[model samples]
Target: MIDTTRLLSGHREGSTLPPLSLDVTKPGNWVVFGPELTAAAGPWGMSFSANLTPDETTGIGSWTEDVFIKTLRTGKHLGMDTGRSILPPMPWYEDLKAVFAYLHSLPPVKNQVPGPVPPDQVMKMLSTQ
Candidate 1:
């Protein structure tokens, strides 16, 4: 059976690579994406996975349920009414409560992920790709 506590907490006790500041050391989880899947980097530039842990100061700990729903529904960052679209490769839609539930249930990790690249740069990269 899956050790959900370890999986959800980002615990990489079995990983080969060293930890990153992006790693949560209290439990020591690595950002281990599968070999077939990769970090998103195309016309939209690069986007790392988000730190969904409930660290109020650094993670989505402040986002309300309404905001989370709006984010999925509108594809806007922080579910802002006018924020940038969630960007490519996300394949998002409405009614993401299960996802939110999983995220909110995790121990609050404090990793600060990078933001999206500028639109112009992404356009340039997309054209090249």
Candidate 2:
């Protein structure tokens, strides 16, 4: 049975470092994507996935449909021009009305994910670990 505990919560655990070689045999060395959409680190540094739940404080509870669509289309946080870039691996898509509806339907999960870490600070963060 699949555990829905952390589903769509983006919960995951492991080293952020890329594997030394392209060895798919080692599952522990790879980064796994959870239903909750957690964090990912690469040459671009660490980026924590945002909580898509309808929680007003931590998630997108306060976001309007227009804001959601614009964020996807423009890749800007809250779809604002002055907001930070949404970062990589987040593909820009069109027509998210249905997607937004479905997301709002789910139970709101209060998960405050960490902010994106710049490339320059990534190594330093790793070194201290």
Candidate 3:
């Protein structure tokens, strides 16, 4: 049986896997999929997975249904016209009202996810390595 609690709570910040190398064609270089989603280091730099629970502070509890739908539909943070692109490997999908409803139904979890690191920073870090 799926542990809905852990699934909804997300993988949390400290549990995130280390940034993956860009050479995904290698045999052992596959991306890992989990409750925290996929964290990829590519041209876009590093993007941490979001906390999908309904926690008011760290999660999506404060988001309106419209905002949720628009975020997925438009791939903009908070669905604002001027908001930064939501970034990938987060895909934009259609028909997510049911998804929105189900996510909101899950118990709120207080996990705080880190934001994305821009490409320049990633390059700088890689150069120093």
**Best candidate (score: lDDT):** 3
Off by over 4 Å in 2: 11-37, 93-129
Candidate 2 displacement at residue 100 in angstroms: 23
Q: What is the lDDT of candidate 1?
A: 0.60
Per-residue lDDT tens digits for candidate 1, residues 19-100, read 3344332333433333323343444444545546676875678889998788888888889888988865666663578879
Candidate 1 worst ten-residue window by lDDT: 29-38
- Of the two candidates 2 and 3, the one with more favorable lDDT, higher being better, is 3
TM-score of each: 0.45, 0.49, 0.53
Flag regions of model 1 displaced more than 4 Å: 1-38, 94-129
lDDT of 2 by residue, 1-129 (tens): 545665544434442544433342254455443333465544444466766778788778899999998898898989999998886456665358978898999999999997898969989988988
RMSD of each: 17.2, 16.0, 15.4
Q: What range of 10 consecutive residues in model 3 has the weakest lDDT sum?
A: 25-34
The alpha-carbon lDDT assigned to residue 93 of candidate 3 equals 57
TM-score, structure 1 vs. true: 0.45
Stretches > 4 Å off in candidate 3: 1-4, 19-37, 93-129
Please identify which of the two predictions, 1 or 2, would achieve the higher lDDT against the true structure.
Answer: 2
Candidate-wise lDDT, in order:
0.60, 0.67, 0.71
